[model samples]
Target: MEQLRVTNQDREHVVEHVKAAYAEGRFDELEFEDRLERAMTARTHGDLMPIMSELYGPRGVPMPRPVPPRATPARMHTGPTESPERLAASAAHGLAAIGFPIVGPLIFLLTGGKTSPYIRQHALEALNFHLTVIGASILLPITVVGVVLLPVIWVAAFVLSIAGAVSALTEGSFRYPMTLRLVK
Candidate 1:
């Protein structure tokens, strides 16, 4: 058959669907990743067919997610609130501050992150932040200036981790400067 060409939107749509499935516990990490890579790289209708088919079994409409009860904040600015999701997010950065390179974010990623987008984003950010720090630590020791900057980097990471934890707890978003997103 002459295949219909796919566009970037088509590929992105498929990827989003796969992510939703993964988030909803329909697919495992390995399976999600394999499907994701294929969806992202698919070239034509033939390429897209199998992915949607496997996920929905020939259904045309995507599965609808249940509506969550909305929480309206009284003010634009809010303080730290105790929640399982927020606690997991705070731990992602707090543990990083204590010098666990991957363990902290890994914990969040494995736990609340699997289902919560909010937690997942924070975990990925923390993981990327520390990965960047570890990479810089290894490469910076070679030069005199780099050696001088090494301790500075550590201090900055320390401060940033605290900031990340606070922001995460308070329903705010925090991003590390110069972080490379290797995980996402």
Candidate 2:
């Protein structure tokens, strides 16, 4: 049995690796819990290195390389460029307007309004379409007889809006369905 050396930095790095692996669903429940426990118990970098090597070695676990940070786009020199968050918001807005308006505005607002203006603009347009559809439906005689459908539409919109909001906050690029491409 060869003893492995660990240093403080190695332990911290190992802990991070283990956490990332677990988050990526590479480990089953038992393995995940066990690995997490081991990572927590790691005291020094040297101690952690060996443990990590063992876990990731043949017949053990496989660890992936850390993801590099994405480069931030430089500020637009002219007009505004779309951000990932904004792209997602735009997508959410389109989905919401198409009878799922619930998620668009929530995503737009929750993203600290820092998302791309393009996304916000698209979402607003979608929202407008959704309102128009609801208005048209309400004015129809058959829709008046089917008043229960009104609540269903509202609920659907609310749910979609919430989803869009969360995605924006998380900086995800979501695409709205059935929306005109107003922004490139």
Candidates in order, TM-scores: namely 0.58, 0.31
* Residue 63 shift from truth in candidate 1, angstroms: 21
What is the alpha-carbon RMSD of candidate 2 to the true structure? Answer: 13.8
The 10-residue segment of model 2 with minimum total lDDT is: 73-82
In model 1, the worst 10-residue window by lDDT is 73-82
lDDT of candidate 1? 0.86
Best by TM-score: 1
lDDT of 1 by residue, 1-184 (tens): 3198899998999998899888987767999999998998888989988999888777766655556446666333343354977888888999999989689898888888887777888899999999999999999999999999999999999999999999898888888899988999
Model 1 residue 28 CA deviation in Å = 20
lDDT values of the candidates?
0.86, 0.55
